[model samples]
Target: MSDLRQAARAAGTGGNGARRRPAFIITIDVEEDDAWSGSATVATRNAAFLPRFQALCDRYGLPPTYLVDWTMATSPAFQEFGRAVLERGRGEIGMHLHAWTTPPILPLTGADHRHKPFLTDYPEHVMAAKVTTATRVLEDTFQIAPVSHRAGRWMLDETYARILVEHGYLADCSVTPHISWRGTSGAPGGRGPKDYTGFPEKPYFVDPEALHRAGGSPLLEVPMTIAVRRYGAVVERARALLSRSGPARRASGRLWPATTWMRPNGRNRRDMIELARRALHSGRDHVEFMLHSSELMPGGSPYFRTFRSVEALYDDIEALFAFASGPFEGLTLSGYRARFAADAGRPPESAAGPRRTG
Candidate 1:
């Protein structure tokens, strides 16, 4: 184990010196089926899997945080389902911004042509407008103001974080630690944040100007759990080397043993479980798991193109839940934040300056 892992493990004890049980937040990026295509038209998306996804959550007694985007937020059927989830006290609704479809579509001018649906890439004014429109749509449709957000494409930055604070959002789950999407084909034209190479895997309060570093800012950054095992340093070096080229970076992400970002679908179950076990052993209090809602239905996502594939995904999720139930208490994003705040004896709000409108 690396020094950081060793230190984290040693620190994973309660105030009384006993090992603290791990907790987890299962977040779903609830959006349109065409999200990956970058051609997502508002009218072309369907949230057909929401009901089934909610049923799975109900079955496992897990309260998931649905980070909905403009498409899902505006769908009456989706809203009805969300209402039921809220009524049953089974889930929390949060914002997931897909800048392209979020409205007030900024004109493609100058660097705007490089737009990648990542809110952070836009001008501050454009970003603010898009965020405002999306948040308002979600509030108006759901009749509840959301306090948590997840940026589309995992492309959040300091500006986005500050905007989130201004909008009264208290938690963000957009950071994927130890990974940087820059130069990858996934982030077209190589315009994405290049700095997450050394971010802490555990949750921490964000410092707007230096998001990777922990500080006293009120906005809680609950990053998705990504753990690199025995060859962590070696993997980091290789990723850094490959990141210089777009094709190389994309290939590196597909390379196994280079690293693992916990996801429930497909071949990730074993890595997810193994990473969770490591986090538990290291004294980390929580693991944030995420997947796209479209992945829940056949023909919705590439990962689940068939009915059998979809069923297999569910089986994998259930198996992970079974393994984690005893070692980790599952909570929604907001629930985890509240618990973390209470444990730290701090108020739920940010301790930094007043929330400013962007």
Candidate 2:
């Protein structure tokens, strides 16, 4: 292990043979309901699930970070719920930019504009403008400057890192660890980013020159906890072989049981606990749990299409929290950032090495 990893492990465990405490974070992508479908419209949005989500947080004492997109930020109902959460001191508001719905909506001119809304595919200036608009709206609506951001579709790059830093964001949770959205076929009209197949699963400072690489960058990249099992290499090989064939890839996805990621509604108690154990053992101090607020409402999301499914999702979350009670302490995104800053002896905003200039 690297010195940084070793030091982090030692600090987490105290290195005195005492058991180490695991740390976990819950992050919700607060956005419109039409996320899966490319039909992102202002009129088809809802924030009705916020109350139930807040109640769940209160029940578990989990202070989650709600990464609100432009639609959610602009919705009066969502704003009211966000205000309630803030007033109750149970959550933090962060920025989540859905480039398509965000302001400065450019005219559909090319494949990039017509297809999926990958922020990196847009011009750096356009991306910056969208980010600026979204950030300003979120800050204005919540009455607090957002310190963290997560790009829609996990489509972040070095330009995004620079923009985030320019906007005073301290952390980003857009990287879904152990997985890549690159070259993956999206809905009939969309395209994803280029390959990020070898990105690290652990949280680290983004390398400014190569956003996929880990290094000393001002922004902390907190990837979602997506652990692959022992057959990860096999799964990768199969995936690569079937990359060009959609049907084959779909078949492989169904047959691949070893490729597991921790999702509230998708992962079982055993898988989540095992993933958490592996993360803690690998010297990781935090395991991030992510979900969409739309999933909390029946029919709001495909994952939870019914009230029963929503209750079941909650059951899964409750089970994971209960299982983690002994080893993991739940924290909000801002709370984790504060703790990380205290441990690093400086703020994340000042932790980057010299910026690369061309």
Candidate 3:
């Protein structure tokens, strides 16, 4: 704990003289209707959960950031939601593109699921077109130009960084390290079984050569933290195993179980807690956490096929906010960007982006 205090001091957020504000960035990837399932097409299913999220934020006097997909924005509900977010003055409306959900590849097949060429191999022109269109739509409809982003499915490559730069997106929150996404078509690479020692758990600028590296990209990768025991396994396995009886067993396996991936060997909730603790103790002040907005909705929705109920999502949201708030001061992405700009000797953070186009 003493070392952590020292680290905080060195990072410019230490001592009563320095006045450190712990920063928590919560980024939600909003792509409710773009999933592989046909039934999940209604935008309202995802929109319905927004009010509760808003209520939660209001109660906490915090602004929640919403990254809206262009396709989802076309719906009336989303348009109103976007306006509401802007009106609240607490949220940021940013782009969340699901290239796989548009045009030729949309209405996806099992094959599309197996091979996500829309994201990984699309021509630069095609990719740019998708991003531009979404950017325009959000700007036009909501009257807000989105400056932050998260790629749908976390499926991206170097091409994405170039695309974001072209589209005027300065910060990206993709790239989950210390985990593998094999067989989950279009997912990025992570540590292999033979090597697991390297990878960053916090945010940093995206390095161009990340694609070729064992862990992958540098795009300000704000990966979710994972906690593990001394034996290199997540600590929650015992509870998960114990809950494996009767309806609980069926529920755990089907309804958003804390599994890392489709593979039997996976990360657990404790993994995240451990990482969060380490970051706090190590003097690191920023902890960026994310989850799909679709998962916050009710069960049986196409967006959250794993069928975790709305209540379950609330539990996750409340717990995460409580844990992070208790340890770190929370900041919206915009707030964090401002701090970065200040550090860079540039204009004030709010003065750092392109003008709104609507």
Tens-digit lDDT track of model 1 for 173-211: 988877877644322433455557788777888888998
Q: What TM-score does candidate 1 reach?
A: 0.84
- Candidate 2 local lDDT, 248-303, one digit each (tens): 87876766654566776544667876776666567678888788878887888777
Q: Whole-model lDDT for model 2 versus the true structure?
A: 0.72
lDDT, each prediction: 0.75, 0.72, 0.58
Q: Give the winner by TM-score: 2 or 3.
A: 2
Candidate 3, 1-358: lDDT as tens digits:
4554444444454323465745667776676543545443345467666767777766665566677786677767767876887886867877877765554343234454444434545666667777877788887898766777777766657677767755667566655555454434442332111111255555555565563242222123444444333322443564467476777666754544433321111123344555556666666667676666666665434434443445555665565565555555666776675565455444444334443222
- Candidate with maximal lDDT: 1
Model 1, position 210: C-alpha lDDT score: 90
Which residue pairs does candidate 1 place in steric collision?
Answer: 9-282, 12-283, 218-350
lDDT measured at residue 303 in model 2 versus the true structure, 0 to 100:
76
Which segments of model 3 are wrong by more than 4 Å?
1-11, 14-17, 33-44, 103-118, 186-199, 209-221, 226-229, 232-275, 300-308, 344-358
Pairs of residues clashing in candidate 3: 22-329, 206-218, 206-219, 225-272, 226-271, 226-272, 227-271, 227-272
**TM-score, each model?**
0.84, 0.83, 0.72
Candidate 2 least-lDDT 10 residues: 349-358
